[model samples]
Target: MKKQFFYIVLMGLVAPLASCNDFLDMEPMSEITPEDYYQTVDQVEEFTNQLYADILTTHGSYSSTFEIDKDTDNQPSTETPGNKYDNTGQWKVSMDNSSWSWTNIRNVNYGIEVITENYENGTITGDETSLKQYLGELHFLRAYAYFSMLQKWGDLPILTQAFNDDEATLVEASKRSPRNEVARFILKDLDLAAKYMTPDFETSHTRISQDCAYLMKSRVALFEGSWLTNFKDTPFVPNGNGWPGTAKDYNKDYQFPAGGIDQEAQFFFQEAVKSAELVAEKYKNSLTRNTGITPQSVSDVNDYFYMFGDDDMSTYPDVLLWREYNKGLGITNHLEVIVQGGYDVTRSMVDCFLMEDGRPVYNSSIPYDDQTIAKARSNRDPRLVAFMKQPGQINYFINEDYPADHARKDEAFPPLDVGDGTVNRSLTGYRIRKGGSFDKARCDQWNSYTGSIVFRATEALLNYIEAEYMLTRNIQAGHILEYWKLIREAAGFTGAAADPQTTNTYTSIDKEKADWGAYTAGKLLTDVTLYNIRRERRCELMAEGLRWMDLIRWRALDQMCKTPYHVEGFRLWDVMQNEYDLEPADYDGGNDAFVTPPSRGQYIIAYENIQEKSNLYRDGLHWMMAHYLEPLPIKQFLLTSSDHADVELSPLYQNPYWPLVADSPAEQ
Candidate 1:
């Protein structure tokens, strides 16, 4: 995997900027210069393959982002931070570095440039169909790089035809494009890509196929449409042009578009559904649930969850795309399950699952917000049990003897002996199982090889259902209920369908199959659909680090920024009184001569270290516009052309919400 990433970067073909002095250039010691590389089909194919490798080179999966997105009200960090408050140890913070982004963009654009040049010159010729297919793949990658930039920085400079010295000269003066325009450009590229891409799943687990393109289109469309419609307070334009430079006060008031939420949202959602359906038509796949598996056929539903346990593609065909991990490549052993001593899913998200009856767990008659956790979770969606672990649930698989003594394996336990007790050690008792391999013994490293799940069949189904729900309120008519049934069956649940409806919308359920209540009643598909997708996304792409982007796009960061899970118990002990019949020390309020109580097992120890809950959820405040878009760096802003300078720059550089650098003096 590392070599694959390195080869892509090293193999990139970028002609150096025009030389100034001939003697200074010398016979440049270069490895297969760009001039000789783009003259053949094989060369182009190799170059594109290397470019795909760049995706693996940049930051390891979404692990960094997940720390900030999932470790708050939505969920808490399962692992206690060695240092609190200065919890920069989380996932996304590491991604804030400017260099990583530039390198990634450079690699992707370089690939695009080579492919485009060959295609234009007619220098590369292959089986016509195969050539077109490969071209589609190249376009898809370039689009993906731009999309990532858009997600992170909102609007970025559009560098479409690749950047050589001349393009660089122009780009150096180019400012940021509006997010709306950038999104439009991405969609255009994808539209062209879809036309040429091979409409099939890749035979190899890690290669991008045609379906991947559609999945990306669906994702980008939904993101833009949702943000434009739902985030009204942060309109794309103030007056006629984009973002007016009037308001200096972050607190004064921020407003986007009014219809960006209600009516306008429906249009984009409809488009999202169309793209999703296209992928499903081509892939012919769906997420398999527990209902189909017999108890005797497999050990449990968990067996299905660990489908990607081995990186050996020879054995596992379920994984669509991945980066291979080899032990010989200096791979070190470290648990890849991010939840163990890192961030975990939020509790609010736990409650976000729909009930067995198709109602939100919150809709239960009981006051879910109160302390009745067991009741709040009772009768909830069965997926919750499959995804999360609560106390008393027997989770075997720790130091059990393998091969000879597989049956005697002991359940792994979380570290609970922190100075502050086990309460803060790991907030969520449950650890994530997604992307974790059970066959670690075969690989030299424990589980260091990380492979990203770029696209899967399940997401296609989700996209289809989300679109269906938006177009028609009636789950039955919209076919939303059917998809829910498919998901439930795949997860091993079987029962009457859940069909719920809203009174205001006059939503109706077929009287014969009122069982489909869950979908009929689900409104704004934003939360329900978001929740459904989030769970599968989390479970499917655990260590690959995809969950963090979803959190940002949905503006769920505030909800996931604080510690969300804490263990609570009654205070039951003081210091010890005596030791081995030694004389007692002088009594003091802060005396060291104290002891814990004998009934320690029964006594409760309150853990204030619960996951910090988010105050930014609901009311759409999570979707606020400040971090919605990233600002160009101060240097770029200054050099931008006058036309772009007229457009508003991000306030972040001027007055950052989060400090860009740590104070050196404070550290001392």
Candidate 2:
């Protein structure tokens, strides 16, 4: 089979620059310049295609991609040194210089500038449709780059135009725009993109289409709106206590586009609702179903599992954007292998899934003590059985001959033994089975040609529900019940439809008791409606690199540091230890050195015995308010001060709570 158009883009961008000294140099006959480039629709499209390779394909390693979900309540990495945010004193102001970089923004802006100038100057002729579509893609890509920056560093220097290498021009572009203004700019770009973009791209789901723009607009708006709502009174948001943004003398009394902060939030939430509703309505019937799914057999096509792992996603209309891979071309990834080995789905994440009967897993009918691997796997949400690896379950379908010592191949419930021969074994007993393929031949291949779903309509559904509820606190609005039913139905839950009036017999109260981080921080999900919506999101999108962002926007990291919350694994200490023939000697250190035996029937607290050395919840995970918005690099401030000596201090302001020192400030 021929490789997909996705690889063509990679080759188109890389082949041209492989031998060039400077991509922008004007002199050489061999080198391409802006004048030579953008002369044709093909060149312009290829230029925009590079954005996908740079931004999206950078996450080709499934292990590293999923690692974003680890060290949080939802998941944990088997190899533990703990994440920077987990320690009380590890996260420092100078640790992240890349967040200060604007290379991607500059590239995107340059592309836009070249295209707009060329089109207006009549230097290039094109089918107007193709030219406008390429322009829309650039705008969307620029907005995407800015959205990424906004997430990491709250306020940013909104650089719409590309600057030359001159220092004065660089310094002029360095003044930080207010966070709210940055969000509005992103929305404006998306609106322009939607106006010029086609509804769908012809080359599968890899390219930016009209729906992709709407979905992203919803995602960006919801993130900003929720951040403002949850943290309105805190310093992390603009115009709040200790907020670092300033309206320079020229724009000191700046008013939000929607009057004030509260109104501004409502404005974005409404935008989120508008955009999300459009996509959700357009793709309401796009959910992929396992038509031939059975208790013992799973079809290799047309199912949720295949949608995530298969090389072709054209059949799944719900997937608005996807990255295709080709093994023959040497463009492949081991996402399936990583799913089988590298990470563990936390017990808290598993518990987040509601039972098949639409009840919490912790309901009195299904108490926590009854949660053995076998018991927990039975009658739970079909997703639990479908997406998670249980003890003694076959991981892959192809019956391949292999060394007996292969860590995961044909292994039944690969023990959570870190020292096991396989590098892919889980630290927590629960392994991720979501994207593992049944085809064993492709499992361990270096360039595994499994496609990656970049965006799906499912997210738009969830976004609409959240934005609508947050804006009006009404679950009945915009077919909330209808969309939720679709999610449940897609997950293989066949029951009487969910009723908003009927309270679930099981409450998150018990589950929250085990995961103290659930109730702490500023997370105030007291209402059943909101709690259920949040629960649905967590369960549906687990291990998808979104949990950390959700937690940050919700301001849910504070409680994690209040006390050392135990990051518990499966009830392996109670059940699997004996069942798997595991011994104390199998651990990192023998008996007294490794794990401390839990009281019978209790869950395994990871690294409980050697907490100090393991970095696993030893000091507890903490989040400083300043961490809400990453600090601009101290070097940037120093450069500004030295370059513009006439100005006594740099015009830039540091995010609140971050000291100018290289080390962390005293504990909050």
Candidate 3:
């Protein structure tokens, strides 16, 4: 996978998509140099346009962003288990950096170079406004590329310009920057991007704007601040115990830019608050209303329910960045699941949503029951429950677009035929209702036209709340109270109920043991205010592909090393079994005896139910200190070396607790 990622980056081939010109026609890089080809702004814009189409992760299948929460407590899937949580430590060192590929980086660097050089040299003949906007896009794209890898690999090579393949130049440039420096570099790029961008671009919302840049900037700041604060004295951080970066000559005598780690972390917290406030303040009134409408209710369709499936999100003010799919251009998305159970979310996600009255379900007086799926969602947060399928619910909430032949995956007691493909589905009883529509065009394979959101403005709100609390250790400080209130109210709370303090008062840290977010660095978080802040984020961004990042940044699952966690779902052995007409028995090729017995637990265990005792996580999910950061690819080390695969000579360093040998797993 690493080699594949490297190849894509090395080749820098942009697959033609639906565009104004022929996307298939290759850019004649050999014939067109900056002196000749980049004379017009449109020419430069065309090159940058490919970044938008190629970089963003548009919908590819039923399990695109929805499946990102798989290993996290928020969501689990039947489509095999994740190596991170299976306790076998199968996350071995790769031959190449698939996840760490710099394909987009190289492209962005090239665009920035030619455009800036041409504009400064008077070679480009266009308005400064358009040229600056396109340059802003390149900068934003570069920052985005770096931020994505920063989460996976804490330390990264900060590549500002495209480099030649000369051995000395390449090896010298491979020196890994400290994680904090990489984060700072990303923020600087975003700063330039925002300075060059407009608040409202003439182009549609599909393009990145100043608001989007600020939101992403806030996200990166909050992430780094949280990580540095949580892993203060750990090997994963620079200058900390057993830090691998300190082993290399360039990083061995590193000095914190802010004097110390604590000061540096505070700097990020301030940056997070500063950038987030810019976006949140502007878009606070723009949060889409939650109409509290379910499929079972007799209300006109809720706009919030259709936000993810809508073909156009340009009008939605709070949606910072989104991708529009056009069927006419042969650029379509395929997320149709013929069966309702393709992407199953975990029950913990349901529990994460607070009761509309601002209280956790464990302590709420709202007469809630956990035995059935319906009872669990009753009177809870509307936005969270809206995407969770309930019994007797229609497969398509609004089916004006689907045709007669369009197959429906309507809920019929959470279909649990766990052997074949679609016939055996819905691993957990909880089904994901995100990106679902009755549109026949969308239901067709590779023919959907729904817009895919790359960045939502709500992230700014989430980042501000967490950053403020982390910095001051008080939600009352700064605009944390105001920002948090907006989020709570948007989720359907009102008056005193909308106040975050109310939830903080009623919250019990012990009761939140099931939630991985409740812990940081292997111990329960003592402050209730911060826990509630985290709870809001977990609820708001359930399956939007940010859960894993949150979990590791907080060091949430560090306790798993001693006390492993079982991946559980709906209560199949309880009265729900009778409601769903399921029999609790041992597995026999997934016939009638597919479910795990009552001895395992009343709720469904995703891994424990497997046959022949072949379950990888039968011992439950566990973690190690080394698991926080991925080991560097062996090929990266080899390329950085003066001669042969001499890892010692290489300026790049492997992550702490990870092995230097190829294909080897973590030492911990």
Candidate 4:
């Protein structure tokens, strides 16, 4: 059935491709000499434009990895009916090996190699310093691709040049490099690129800037260092790369490959701290801060979160890197998949946050039932209110209930305007409002239509806070508090500017202090602050494609999956379909087509407590392996070196050294 669907979709796309070619064939294109191609600044400008397009094509909205990895934005309903596969319920498989492969690497290398060769051969000459700058941009882009590769597949073949089909076929079976080696290579490229790139956003969204290179380096170094040092128990080794049959190389490797878990942790943490500090200091002007007049109302709502909203861009005080959503080049549409029922906010994450006094609400000290939970939720972080709308709150569009489908939309629609129902509201009793638009004239029914793709300075600050808190508890406490203060101030919390819609719980104070020292290495900030940081991350980055990676790195999928599942609630008065005198045509919205109900009068919104055997929390871990990693193409594995049979495994299929299982092989 899935195969049939794939073929049908693929076939449907052919007509558009044919139409595109027809138009392109008639358009007269410019002919250029090698000298003219990179000669003047104008040609260089065009090259940068093409580079941006490349980045967008590979890493932008269309990136499957990004979509699959982040559990926040779900797969389109058209793609996954009933939203069953979307919750990432399936196990990892080796399908689409070509899609997961490092095919893009060669193209990036080719572009860089060509640009660099031209500059070196004196085919294109300008200010020698600026020429190096152009070269730096290319290097940064190439480095970016490799960094992405290392993250996806810990150790992979580091192909430096573009390979022809013949060359690819002729080359001896290559072994994967160690992750550490890949990290070192990436850093070297980034550092070299930094020298030539300028720290500006003027050229194009795709061009490499110094700040962007630094930003990328900091993020890469932090994740690599943190994950390697911390993930010791798993198949992952801390200091060295995972390539088969090679002594760890520290210099050529990312770090000095000598330390054990603790030693590596300290080293990586130190690097993360240093890199984060550099980006923070250098890009102070790029921070996202609220410029609104109501200081108090907006102080706790980070400008960074709002930066994605159309009206909030000019207010971002610190925006270092951003992708352009251009209508001019016919790339205006931002393809994002948003679930109407708060599908991204897993039940587990909802339970993880503490009450206003920084005490876990789930603890025995508090009541575990609905009433207490509702009251406790009020006293929590200000960002929570910014992100979710509770049962009774009014926003742009009042989400009456968490209905399962459009069938409930018709049932919930009241003859006299009032409310949907009492029991069927959001389970957390909340709906998302962050990415929502405030344009009274336009209502946001389809997601991709909202705001821009923004990268803010708050993320840099948050990264620093996480690194620092992990390293030292006492000394970094003050710094962590300072960063939080900045975040709060910028988010619009305080006296007069306080939003009327903001959670009253922001003002609710907790008098008692609960113990978290035992759970978090005795770090003061590690307890409440850690959860707050995560909450902030969720609130700010929700539906922006960061949740899944956060879950993986934190290894919290097991906990997150346990979160409650609730559809928008709809009140049911009867079971008969004919009572309303409605026909099938009256029920069709065309927007929500996959969803249906058990009967006509029954509201599909409320989560009927059906005793299903499957549990989200227990099953969540399976998604990590299945959706996060794509298996190595079986055909490619067959082409591997005979001596290194184990190397054929894809990270998704199993760890590199695991014995191959026939049922789990890519062929199956």
Clashes within 3 Å, all models in order? 58, 1, 4, 46
User: What does candidate 4's lDDT look like per residue over 338-446, in tens digits?
Assistant: 3222222333344444333333454433353323223423544445445543433323222334232221211122221112532222322223444433322223222
lDDT of 4: 0.43
What are the lDDT figures for the candidates, one per model? 0.43, 0.67, 0.75, 0.43
| Best-matching candidate per lDDT | 3
Order of candidates by lDDT, top first? 3, 2, 1, 4
What would the TM-scores of all predictions be? 0.65, 0.88, 0.92, 0.65
The candidate 4 region of ten consecutive residues with least summed lDDT is 1-10
lDDT of 1 by residue, 1-668 (tens): 11111111111212242344421122121244456665666665666676675654222433332344343334444433212223232222221236225555555555566656777777766665666766777777778877777776664556653333232344342434545557767877788777876655356655566667777788887776655543444433221123432333441243333333454456567767888777665544335443222111124545344543434443333344555555578433333434223234433345445555544443443233313233434555555544443333333343223332112122233332243442234333333334444332432224445444445566666667655654674556554656555655555555542332321122222211111111211122323443443444443344444444554455443221332322222122222111123222311111232211233332221222221232111111111123434333333322232333422432322211322232211110
- Runs in model 3 lying further than 4 Å from the true structure: 1-31, 59-63, 295-299, 336-342, 397-406, 580-593
The lDDT, on a scale of 0 to 1, for candidate 1 is 0.43
- Cα lDDT for residue 462, candidate 1: 61
lDDT of 2 at 387: 68
Best by TM-score: 3
Sorted on TM-score, best first, the list reads 3, 2, 1, 4
Task: Write down the lDDT that model 3 would get.
Answer: 0.75
User: How do the residues 1-668 of candidate 2 rate in per-residue lDDT, one tens digit apiece?
Assistant: 21111110111111122233543333212245565778878777777777766656333444335556776788865555344455556667773376566666667777787789998887767687888888998898889888888888887778776444444545556777778789999999999999988766465877788999999999999999988887886767777766656434423555677888899999999999999999999888878864323122354343776777777977788988887778788787767666655357767777776666677765635454434766766667777767666555665565455322223644466455545465655555666666666555666646466777778899999999889988888877777888888877787766552443332335655455544234535444466777777778887787777886787777766654455556666776655666765555554343333443554236765555444454445433545555666766566665555343323366566777766655555234
